[model samples]
Target: MRIIDAHHHFWKYTAEEFGWIDDSMSAIRRDFLPADLKSAMDAAGVDGVISVEARSILGETGFLLEHARQNPWVYGVVGKAPLSQGKSAVEEYLAKTLPGADKLVGVRDVLQGSPIEVFSDATFNDGLSALAPHNLVFDLCIYHNQMQATIELVDRHPEQRFVLDHIGKPNIKDNVLEPWATQFRSLAERDNVFCKLSGMVTEADPTNWTAEQLQPYFDTALDAFGPKRLMFGSDWPVCLVGVEYPDWLSTVKTLADGLSESEQADFYGNTVLKAYRIDAD
Candidate 1:
């Protein structure tokens, strides 16, 4: 399979810049750059990676774009924009940064921490509208509770391409499936929206999470989005908090063992290529 790890990150770790890397995440407190990721991708037979922004800053996007320029294996970037800056500012930033448009495939905000109502804000919606004209995707990085807002956002901007990062970030650690599964299914009804099969491990009981533990959530996504709309992503350095790269890849592979060769292709790589407009070459 032509494997594309659709959601990993590359960062020069500094506590002040990435305050999310608290003492609990001490294992990933060090720097993680292209060289470090390339080694892991090579070992796991991953062909390339779509670098997602870890920090919700424009500088982080610039860093990924520079990394993409330097590293061929960094296939594309889902970078951050100042969404709170309102529409005109976002449009200006996109015009400036997207001149290198081939590598800058999408934009994201760390919505997991923001108020759900942010999705409904006039400024945010206006900023989102700007992306459709540029043919850029938006990566929705929200928690499960925010799905209603996400659904409303996706519905309002039917022309915009949105990918739900982390499958709406289910609370697998608590084994709470109710509202998440239902809301996820509702969100999947929007044809313009896609979902990433990423970030599950950290949502689970990190240290002792089994493949079996992840299967239900995986199955829910598969059933809801089907292989064509669902793409695989490692959620990398964050994934390392719960499971190693190879093991996580293996677990996804095993869960997908029953898929046909073509279905496997979509999950492993093809879906991202289409969704992000990644230049596979």
Candidate 2:
């Protein structure tokens, strides 16, 4: 199927920087570099991956670009920089860091923990403006509650290509999908926006989540964005907190089993290549 894991991460894990890895996520507390992910991808038959930034630091882009340079399977990178500082900072950061980072196809700033007001901030929207000129996709990583504000943000940037990370991070833990589903569909109405079918396991009961519990959310994403705008993502090391790499892949396959061959292709790889503008060659 030419599968590309559209979202995953590579990190030299440390408590200080990866503080989000609370005691519950102890399994992924150690280093997870290209070699570790290579093994997992090989076992799961994943052809390549887009390494998303785990830390919202300037150095993270370079670190991921280095991994992509060293490993052919690391197809592209979703980097991080000072996006909230406004357009000038984004321009300067890209000018300095993007010199040789051809593998860096996108940028992301952690929106999951930010105040909802950040979504409507003019400076942040300006920063998002800076990415369009460079052809960099801006990954939206907000929680489900922030969807309305994000819809506004996406509305502000029609020229920008935005990938909605984790399907707006719906609240699967409590089986709540009201406002999230409504807001999610509204966001998908924008043609420039795309969605990644990753990070669902962690959003659910990590230890006890069943594929059945995740079905509706996936169905919602499929119905909203369809195969063309929806792509598969492992969410990797974070996914390990809930399900093993291979099991997650299996679950996704089962959930998406109704897709025709071409639809499967779009969901698995084609959407990623189109969204990231990754060169298939």
Candidate 3:
């Protein structure tokens, strides 16, 4: 199928750096580098990966860029930089960091914990403006409640390309839909925006989630974005918190079973390539 995993993570974990990996996440508290991921990708028939940043730190971006440099299987990277510093600082950081590393295709901020209004800030919008000139995409990693603000932010910058990480991070754990579905439909109305069919496993009843449990959210995304704008992402290592790579792959595939072969191709790889502008070898 020529699968391209649109989202996953690689990290040389340390307690000081990855304090977010608390006691319950011990399974993923250790290091997970390209070597570990390559085996999983191979097992799942994934041809390439766009490694997304797990930490909101400049060093994490450098780490992924170096990994991409060393690993042929890593097709691209979604990096992290402090967008609160506004446009010039972001430009300077990109100038310093992205010169030799061509695999850095996008930038992200872990907006899940932030207030919704943060997306509307002038400084943040200025930082977002710096991306288009560099040909970098932005990965929006906000919770579902922030969709209105996300929509506003995306509306303000039609020139910038964005992929909404985790399908707006719907509240699957509680089976809540309403406002999320409505907000998602609103966000999908933006032509420049794309959505990832990833991160759902962890958001569900992680220990006992059924494909049926995830189907509604998947259906919502598919309906809103259609096959062309929806891409598959494993959200690996972190996905280990809920399901293994093969199982998650199977679940997503099953949900997408109704799609035509070409539509399946778009979900599996083409959408990722088009959205991120990934140059796979």
Counting clashing residue pairs in each candidate, in order, gives 0, 0, 0
Of the candidates numbered 1 and 2, which has the greater TM-score value?
Answer: 2
lDDT of 3 by residue, 139-170 (tens): 99988888888899999999999999999888
**Top candidate when judged by lDDT against the true structure:** 2
Candidate 2, residues 124-238: lDDT per residue as tens digits? 8888899999999999999998999899988899999999999988999999999999999999999999999999999999998999999999999999999999999999989
lDDT score for candidate 1 against the true structure:
0.89
- Measured over all alpha carbons after superposition, the RMSD of each candidate to the real structure, in angstroms, is 1.0, 0.8, 1.0
How big is the RMSD of model 1? 1.0
Model 3 earns a TM-score of 0.97
lDDT of each: 0.89, 0.93, 0.90
Candidate 1: clashing pairs of residues: none
Residue 116, model 3: Cα distance from true site in angstroms: 2.3
Residues 41-140, candidate 1, lDDT per residue (tens digit)?
A: 8888899999998877788888898999999888899998777778899888987888755799999988887887788898888877888888889999
Q: Which pairs, if any, clash in model 3?
A: none
Q: Give the winner by lDDT: 1 or 3.
A: 3
Question: If scored against the real structure, what TM-score would every candidate get?
Answer: 0.98, 0.98, 0.97
